[model samples]
Target: MWTINRFPGLWLLPALLPVILMTVYPIGHALWTSLHEVMILFPGEPFVGLRNYGRVVASNYFQDALRNSLVFTLFAAPSVVILGTLIALFLQRRFFGSHVVRSIVLLPWVLPGAISAVLWVWVFHPSFGILNGIMRDLGLIEDSILWLTNPRTALMAVTFAHVWTQIPFAVVLMMAALSTINSETLEAAAIDCRNPLKRFRYIIFPEIKAMIVVLLVYNALIAFTSYDLVYAMTGGGPGTATTLLSFQIWRESFSMYDFGAGSAVAFIVVVISAALIVAITRALPSDLFAGD
Candidate 1:
């Protein structure tokens, strides 16, 4: 029979085995494939030694996708965080029917991404869409605006859709963090600092600083890896105006059947994501994460 001290490593094998098989193996295979010339059209995956990476790096598609992803992250992450924080603060206040409002606020986030994307597709429709109709009624535009079709607005449209879903998630996290903040601290700050901004800056900000950092990193990652929304809405069309890195990888591997290039892009994405997460973690204030 196995004893506690006798075979500690063996006892850990069960949990470790699943992780190795599921995560470790897939990552290892992807890295190996990226280094080779993998083609479904041809026979064996021949070793190319970074040629796949070089090819993808040189491709115009990769360049466009990278730029689009960056733009999306830049706009969407901030919108999510800002809107979420505001919404959370509003919901945090004591008021009549606040519970109902809080429940309503979660509807967008609770909806499936694909479903939201589909709904936005209709919202962005050139002629019959409600947004265009509303704009026309308000005399904002003489004609309907092709939101997802136009190159200039396509990326922004996708970013808006992503932000819409992300805001709720941010709100939830913000509210949770706000709950952890001591009420007496806020009340004391309220007396000292009459200005709301001053109160937030001095008292509330420090308490929720760690959550904000985490949310930024989370939002950045989600925006960078956006696919379902783009796929459902834009299809990476309008001359690849909204083609993100994740969507490009999907197009390369499944649509184009270039596994080597796809894997190379995937690994690059993983590396960038890891680096961003690390940087965000490091950027957090020392006291933000310090345990008492």
Candidate 2:
């Protein structure tokens, strides 16, 4: 039953070569480039070994950026999962204009992430900005606050924009998972005298645990690799307070002309993302996409 010809698992990998070419080629090239120091867009160019990675490892700035990336990932991932679940659950009900509302929510996710970041950059402008104007109109503030310029609130501000953009994606993904739950079972739960909260906890929640874990991992990866928002908003300004690893990689490669160090940072980010995806997959029960 498990014969090679029967299973066809070996050929399956070759069939994936096109995808591998798209993703793996760049990674492999970068890994090679990371070891050699060279500058193409600058006046002077030279080749060096792992010295770039060594420099990055010793730099306090790189460490700070890595820490900030983790912080953003930690906060953003859980928020997307929990808040998105609530929104999805609410929309799962039959309500007036529920379909229309769901469609509107997905508009953000449909927009290019970089474009979304640019829009928020305008929204966060300090003087005579829309955000501050609204706050003043609502009696929330007397002065416009510099959202992207202030280190204390820069990360939070960027995170708010990211969360708003990502929530729709989570809602759509969760709703698909929720739709797979047996409607008869839900109807029975309603008939079984369990309160709404209890019904969710005991019935709906357990069925979606695997999907939740998968989505959490995906959200964490998105937050981990975030670059566009920070690039558009702060450019790692306010003393590198809101700089993530991806932005740091870009700066190192482009601004400082250190491709080797940037490649190392990129490699580390990939490792982090892959490890997280693997861990989440492990935590999920074995029955995902499998019939009981």
Candidate 3:
């Protein structure tokens, strides 16, 4: 009788085949395409080696898009984890209307990204929007803020929208992690540590640290590649102020018909994202995954 370990590769082939066909094949095709000049301006899709990559790298528009993506990730990722964890802690307790509150928390994330963008666009609208009207009623400011139009505020506005949708997912994940904490362990910690902060520091903090790290990395990846929200909300407008790498790739490939250059940019984005995931995985405490 042959053991399962003797035929590990054979057993895994069925599962791995679909992944290779779906992911690896497409990536290989893109890399091959990126090596040529496939735009309308060029006939026959002549081989250009790394010229497409060079063009993409040299373009000022691409640089601006990269900067905007980085800025969005910086603001949105941390906000998602912090706000999510805080809200999760609040909702995890048994209190009056807690179920309703948890349901309400999921509303933003459940809505489609484009829908959320459209909803927020109205909320942030300059004239007669709820946000502006409320601020005015409170005598906060006389003038309405251009939340999505002005270059100064456009990226941050989108970040706010992205974070709103991300928080619910964080809450869901962190809540699950919180549920795994043993009640007896927490009770013992409470007895030894009178202060709430110390109890949380010695007990709750250690248990939830891994979840928080995972949430941060997950949120960062989403923010880095976010496209639909930006498209529906700002259209990467106010003159490329919010044109992230995803939108930039869309513009290059579909709008300008620069398939080769777009593929080069996309491959670069993939490389960066992969590197970030690896870094995040490496940063996890060794003991965090010891059981697995």
CA RMSD of all predictions: 2.3, 3.5, 2.1
The candidate that wins on TM-score is 3
lDDT digits (tens) for residues 1-292 of candidate 3: 3777687678888899999999999889889889988887667888999999998999999889999998898889889999998888789789999999999999987899889998999989999678889999999989999988999988888888889988989999999999999988977987888997788777897888888888888988999999999999999998999999999888989999999988998888888888878987787778875543
Over 4 Å off in model 3, which ranges? 1-5, 40-43, 281-292
> What are the lDDT figures for the candidates, one per model?
0.90, 0.86, 0.89
Where's the lowest-lDDT run of ten residues in candidate 3? Answer: 283-292
Count of backbone clashes, every candidate in sequence: 0, 0, 0
Candidate 2 vs. true structure, TM-score:
0.87
Model 2 lDDT per residue over 78-187, tens place: 89999999999999999899889989989998988789988898888898568998999999998789898888889998888888888998998899989999999999
Candidate that scores best on lDDT: 1
Kindly state the number of residue pairs that clash in model 1.
Answer: 0
Ranking by TM-score: 3, 1, 2
Q: Estimate each model's TM-score.
A: 0.91, 0.87, 0.92
* CA displacement after TM-score superposition, residue 24 of candidate 2 (Å): 2.4
Model 1 steric clash pairs: none
Residue 157, model 3, lDDT: 86
lDDT of 1 by residue, 1-292 (tens): 5575787788889899999999899989999999988889989988999899999999999899999988888899878999999899889999999999989999998899899999999999998888999999999999899999999999988998899988988999999999998889878888888999878887888788778887999998998888898999989989989999999889989988999999999999989888878977787666776763
